[model samples]
Target: MKVRAYGKLNLTLDVLGRRPDGYHLLDTVMQSISVWDELDIQTSRQPGVHLQCNKDRLPTDSKNTVYRAAKFFLEDCGLADQGVYIFIKKYIPSRSGMGGGSADAAAALRGLNEMFKTGLTTEQLMAIGARVGADVPFCVMGGAARCTGVGANVEPVAPLPDCWLVVCKPPAGMSTPRAYSILDQYPLSSTQATPRMLEALEAGNLKRVAKCLGNRFDETIRLAPVRALKRAMVDAGALGSMMTGSGSSVYGIFVSEDQAREALETIDSMGRTFLAQPCSGI
Candidate 1:
């Protein structure tokens, strides 16, 4: 079985508060993009899960979410005797706030279910995914969504208008834990951009959507490369641009593919750049 693990962008992220358990409360809009990694799975007579990735730096053992996801799914379905080998063709950059790892884990859950003939519903898969990572549920239920409660509570929403997305990631990666730690030092605010962004999305007005593009992390993490990338996107005629999720990767919404391609050329040398579109559905 083969699955495409798509990357995601946070159209609007608001840190509501912190939970007693230490997970930050989040109300955000998440959208999958065309940029993705691929996962291939095959049944193995061996009674254990195995994983391999194109990226040598990533762990292929139990530490990997993909491996854990397979184990979780099998155990949940009472099919531990079933074994599978997972191979990942990685494209999405790690630690770019792009949900690359989460997406891969989601793919494992999906692919294993299909390969093993485990008739698990989408909700069931997402429930299993949530246990692995907060973002896994959203990746399982792809496309546009309003995610809350540590990003596992996903509510599908109206899709964004078809527009080109220019995603750029700097060489430096930002750790999510570190980003949240920095955010803790700052005072919380009642102001939120998610509500306005949701309204704009429902209205299908790209201009309003652009105006409401925001990420709370932007106010916290100050990096010269991220700032430069955002500016370059705007100068290249993007309707709007913002850093997705915590840090590092920044994306711009462009009305025209031609314009987005032109923008990609301008920033290609700055960092890894990908031209993508909003994924329409799961």
Candidate 2:
């Protein structure tokens, strides 16, 4: 089975507070983008998960989310005796806060279900996915969603209006844990843009959606490249721009493909860049 696992962008992210378990509460709007990673998976009689990636630097063992997800799914489904081999064609950059790893894990769960002929429902798959990673549930569903409660609780929302996005990731990547730690130092605020962003999405108002773009991490995680990239995006005619998820990768929303392509010409050489649009249907 072959599966295309798509990355996501945060339309708006707000940190609520730290939970007793140390996981930070989050209220955010997440949208799957056209950018994706491909996974080719097949079942085997051998009772172990085998994994390979085009990117040699990534781990192929239990440390990798793909391997862990395979184990989790098989165990949960009472198919622990079954095994699978996974080959990954990676596109999304690691640690860029694009949910690349989670996407891969979600794809593995989906492919394994098909390969094994398991009749699990979408909700069942998403529930199992949540055991592997916070973003896994959202990645499993794919499209526009409001994710809260450490990002495992996903509520599908109306799709955003068609628009082009220019995504850029700097050489330096930010750690999610570290970003949350930094955020914990500051006191909580009542300000939140997710509700307004959702309202704009429901109304199909692209301009309002652009104006409502916000991220709580932007206030605490100050990376010069991220700031510069946002400015460059606006200077190149982006409707609005903000860093997605934790840090490192930034995306700019453009009304048209021509404008997005023009902005890419100016920002592409600056770092690893990609031009994409809103994606749906997994």
Candidate 3:
């Protein structure tokens, strides 16, 4: 089975609090984006997972989310004796906070379930995926959702208003763990971003949606290049701009593709940029 793993953007991300297990509770609106990675999977007579990725730096062992997804799915389905092979053609940049890894893992689970005819429902896949990563459930469901509680609780919402997005990533990558550690050291700036974002989405107001774009990471860790990229997007006619995920990648929402393309050119020199739009859930 072949599956596509679409990337995601954070229209609003807030850290509600930390749990006793040290997991930070989150209340955020996540949207699927046109950016994606593709995976080809098939069952093998061998009794272990085999993974091949286009990116050499990516791990292919148990540490790899793709491998873990396969292992866990097989074990869950009483097919642990079965083996699978997966080849990932990656387009999404890693550590961009775009849920690339989680998307890939979700895709792997979807493909494996189909390959083995496991008959697992979407909810079942999501439950298994949560063990792999918090963003996995949302990615499995696709479209737009308001996710909370370590990202395991996903509430599907109205799709984002049709718009173009200029997504740019600086060369500096962010470590999610390190960012969370740093974020804990300081107080937050705003906690209402999710509610405002939900209101904007429900109204289908692109401008309001853009204005509601906010990330707690942006307020807590003001990376120099990230701020610059956000400015460039606004200067090039974006409705509003903000950093997505933890730190590195920033996106600007635009009402039209032409505006987004122009903004892309404006930021072309500043970082690795892409012209993207909102994507529906699987």
Q: Write the per-residue lDDT of candidate 3 for residues 102-208, one digit (tens) a residue.
A: 99999998888888888999999999999999999999999999999998899999888988999998998889999898899987545669998998999999988
- State the C-alpha lDDT per candidate: 0.91, 0.91, 0.90
Q: What's the ranking of the predictions by lDDT, best on top?
A: 2, 1, 3
**Residues 1-282 of candidate 2: C-alpha lDDT, one tens digit per residue:** 789999999999998887898898899999999999999998777888999999999999999989999998999889988878899999999989799999999999888888888888889999999988999999989999999999999999988799999999988788888888888888764689899999999999998999999899886787899999999999999989999999779999999999999999999877899999999838
Pairs in steric clash, model 2: none
* Deviation from native of the Cα of residue 121 in model 3, angstroms: 0.8
- Residue 156 error, candidate 3, Å: 0.4
What is the Cα-based TM-score of model 2? 0.98
Error of 3 at 98 (Å): 0.6
- In candidate 1, which residue pairs clash? none
lDDT of 1 by residue, 187-214 (tens): 7646898999999999999989999998
